[model samples]
Target: MRFSSRVNAGAMNPIAAQAAAAKAAGHPLGQLNDSNPTHHGLAPQFLPEAYTADPRGPLGARQAIADFINASRGRGVDSANAPAAPAVDPSNLYVLSSTSEAYAWLAMLLCNPGEAILMPKPGYPLIESICNLTATRAIPYQQFFDGSWALDLASIENALREGNGSVKAIAVINPNNPTGAYTKLGERQRLVELAKRYDAAIIADEVFYDFTLEPFDGNARWAGEQGVLTFSLDGFSKMLAAPHAKVGWIEVSGPAEDVAQAERHLDMISDDFLPMSNLIADCIPAMLQEAATQTERVAARVRGNMAELHRLLDADKQSGDGVVDVLRSEGGWNVLLRFPSSIDENALGLRLAHDFHMNCQPGYYFDMQSNGFLSISLLPEPTQFERNVQIILEAVHRELA
Candidate 1:
């Protein structure tokens, strides 16, 4: 039995292997790498009416999504300081199971076998698997971090130029995972220009759009951008803290001809799978209307945990032997901590699990370029999170001593 090389090339990386080993050890693991809100006790309540709804989903749900995007992105408001983001049309929205499925559909729509897609380095690692599944190639462009993460436009342009026009699409995660840097307006403009120049589509994953911790000046919605075909992906996974609900969407916008052609292809792709559960689709309007309540709970938890982390780290620094430096994160559910150069991240992670009974992810899991970085979840229960942080700090201090 012969399998395709793409399938053969795709396997779980070492980080996942270590995580599994830790789980199998049956110790009381304080998980600091969790992202699932439900696991942290933030599940949403669904309406009973959802159970008997149409399989294609209700129009009301799509309209609710449009309204949520418009209001959140500061569109249709009278404020002078607000970005002039156009209102999203419900007709352009298509429901899906999750962002993972959305990526797969987009990959199928944009690329043929062996065609390339540009992704960001030090970003989410799942895109490679998505591309591999669709028989597409995932090429990464660098994002350099000084005080904050910045787009390396020269690197992106070089990637496109070097691809010889085989690059089908570029993926941008607004308020990117781990790094938590929002794509600025200038960066978005440059990206659209690059896409137009290379004749490729743009895939904007704004799943963490609602979790901004500071006042940001740029627009979050990409649904109404002109001149280039753009697919803006988001879902209930992050917005309502309802990952178990498995609801997501893609909003298509561009020149009329391009959008129409893309929609025709996407419709066929979506129809074949019909992945969105009817119940979740029907519950979307209520879920979205009540989203603030759930998101506020999550936001408060994340903020509380982050504050505790900072306070603890500050105390450690005051002790004059602190070995961890918390990286600046503008938004998102995870925070990055850079440890001393002497510590091996993988070894530290293993030791934390086996000796300290704390489960945390090493930075290599997120494609960090160095060995001393660790990514810890900000979504764990507050008390558990505090305990985990103290354990982590003690371990680091011991190592430094």
Candidate 2:
């Protein structure tokens, strides 16, 4: 019996296999790559009534989301000079089961089989997996790092030019996973211009939008951007620490005609799946209203972890050659640490797991170009995170010695 090639391509990823093995072995793996908020004790509390509410997710839920986004935008705007940003239209939003589903729908909406979409390199591998499932091609453009990660716009142009007009969309993970750098205003403008030049759509995965470490002065939300068709994706998973709830959304915007047409197509696609669960959907308003408290808890944890990491690095530098150098992250749940050039990341990960009983994501898992980089989560329990960092430092030092 012949099977579809796309199905074959969707095999279990290596990192997942490693994690599963550790779990099955009953090892107390010091998880330093966890992204699920539930694992970090940040689960959202829902009202009892939400459980038996309408099976169709309530309209109030979408309105709550629209209100949340607009408030967020207002906060980001400079009150002294900038005009109040327009509120996001609730009608423009479509609920989904996960960001993965949002991407899948967008893939179907934009690409025919074998067509291409541009993705950022040193980014999450989920995009490739989604593309594989949809029979679309994922073309990666580079994000170069100096002091901070920045888009290589030239590389993006090159991908589009050489794509032979098959590139249908550009996907941006704002405050990208692992790297944690937000897209600057100039970068966004250029991206819109490029999309217009190529007649392509933009997909901004702003799941980590609320986790910015620095002050945001520009328009932080992407749902109201003009000139190019855009789909800004976010969800309760990250915002409310409710991944188990499985609620996400796509906010569509552009020229009125374009947005209207896209909404129609999206409506049909979403209706066919009817992905979101009513319980979580009905709880959206309360979850969002209480989001700031939950967010502050996460932010505090991340900041504490970051501060400790920097202190450790500084101590190492004071003693001798530093064993690990942490790249600066503007926002996100993970931090990237670069070790000695001689070490292989995969071997380092294995050593950390077997010898240190700790597990971390190797940089290569995120398409990082180098061998010495390791990505560790900032979302782990505080005490465990500090202990893990010490173990990692000691192990690296012993290796270098």
TM-score of each predicted structure versus truth: 0.83, 0.83
TM-score, cand. 1 vs. native = 0.83
By summed lDDT, the worst window of 10 consecutive residues in model 2 runs over 1-10
Model 2 lDDT per residue over 72-151, tens place: 65733556765544567888787777889999988887887898889999999999999999999999999989988889
Per-structure clash totals for the candidates: 0, 1
CA error at residue 121 for candidate 2, angstroms: 0.7
Against the hidden true structure, what lDDT does model 2 obtain?
Answer: 0.79
Residue 252, candidate 1: C-alpha displacement in angstroms: 0.8
